[model samples]
Target: MQDKSFSPERQSAFDARFEAQKIAFGPIVFQCVRYAWKRGMLQALAEAGDTGLSVDELAATGRWTPYVLKVVLETCLSAGVVQLRAGRYQLDKTGYCVLSDTITQINLDFVHDVCYVGMHDLDRSLDAGKPLGLQALGPWPTLYEGLSSLPEPAKTSWFAFDHFYSDTSFPAILRDVFSSGARQLMDIGANTGKFSRAALAHDAQVQLHLVDLPQQLAVADITLREAGVRERAHLHPVDMLDPAAPFPAGMDVVWMSQFLSCFSEPVIASILQRAAKALAHDGQVLIMDTFWDRQRYDIAAYCLINTSPYFTAMASGNSKVYESTDYIRLCEEAGLRLVSARDDIGYCHSLLRFAKA
Candidate 1:
């Protein structure tokens, strides 16, 4: 797979205009390529290998009509998802990503199923500082609240998108998180208890408290029981959104994974302060999240940055894929000093370790 760089600012005015047109045409291009992907036209080209395939050939082998195949393929060609060589169409790197990349496909489906309709209310969501777009899905204030209630493909795609990033990181980060040999760990925002289960399995002596909303705790409880780690895992149903709600105290390790981005800066500060207050003498808070500025790849950075809109329009209206500097400052303001930090852990995520100053 080839990754090429295109620098339009260094080019002529006409070239820059052409680049702008790409953005202008992005919606239609996305839909057309998505169509090709779903219809298996891109897969046919991929299976055809370097020999490629003609639109007529793809139609004959598949259920699609030649005219429809021709339309989708031509749009894909313009989008650089497909290339035409000697009257044969083949998948480009972009097209291959759509068809074969797990993360890419998950993200594509998530956008289609979860955000496509709601995102149209982005302007209103921004103005109100609330997830006004969420009404399109259901009558929930945030995506997290409506997660379990989501319909069909939306629920499937949401979990797939959420799990893909976090699941891959658990194995690699367990050692770091439990490095202090914490006997009493608290998994704050324990959505599914996956991390809590992993923590129990990582260290036989450790006991973990899984904290989240009651509904979220219910989901996590089942998984923990199935994993046979329920004995060591204590479920604490707490609403972190409640300003007066205090975290479980005497915690040796307070762990939150992809959790803090669901709130505004002030709420994050409050939560961190509560965590700091709840910490034992040697306790540390470990946070694992994808920060836009910490990303090594531009593509990863772009995806992380773009997620801010989803927060604004679907999830919490004020949260975002926070920059590392800003996030660290927020933690520090809560009296938790950033003692150690590691970036590029399991894809685009960063692990931050903090202790009370």
Candidate 2:
């Protein structure tokens, strides 16, 4: 008889039962929290930047209408995005960074500007294997492009969401990943080149390449220059998924963070293949991404129902969170062997390391 600890039958039974419960009760709590998050974000934005707006003023000057603003503001007030100071609204620090000009659009714009639109098609996306949100927005279907059309303030405010979340795992993960001290590194889809700055600051010897869209490259140039690392920084403006785009061959490390999920399996496969091709013989590739968990059904449900819809909507309707095993398969297919796997930082995120085989 096999030991119970090593029995596949026992594991499968437990995993399946847990998955069933997550799909049931998780949606209700997720919807409640999601509504609260959206409202709080809008309220905080309306209050921040020394441009505080009352509910009436927000309805007049902001995107949300008067009636909607009133309800949402109240919701946000309850959620702690706003403080009721003498019956006036003001932003809390967390609210300020997420909603105001402090971070990226994932929160401020993502909730109202994009997620709301895509959510309308959640059922369709589920049915068609593409996000209805992306389909409704454009022919090609992309969340980043949809938000890309937003005017100032909103566009600038959107950066905070991505920036803040990424920093949560830094220094710790940085120390573990680059303990050996790498010389040259490439940050693919490097938004604002913030990660590059971290790596550069951690090791002065490391030269950096910051690659992203032409528009983002322009922003990154200013940031890197301000940080006094512009001399070591090289900007490459191109879509990361485009095979025709040129990238320097042979690097000590290639890093992609919270970026791969915004792609379909085929595109990610192509990217992995290309990244593997670009690595030096001893070079390593680091991927930071979301993963499914068996122990936490609530978390898994939240990821699929709340988190995934937005990502799918944002990535031109192709992105979906993949299992860790699926990601390993892609790496293997690209001739990269998994060196280490850890879910040390973000509860939802998995840190994967790969080396050319």
lDDT of each: 0.88, 0.66
Clashes of each: 0, 12
- For 53-95, candidate 1 gives per-residue lDDT tens digits of 8767877776888889888899999988999999999889999
Taking all chains together, each candidate's TM-score versus the true structure is 0.95, 0.67
lDDT of 2 by residue, 227-262 (tens): 888889888777766876666777789888877877
Per-prediction CA RMSD (Å) = 3.1, 9.0
Q: Give the TM-score of candidate 2.
A: 0.67
Candidate 2: list runs displaced more than 4 Å.
1-110, 123-141, 146-158, 294-297
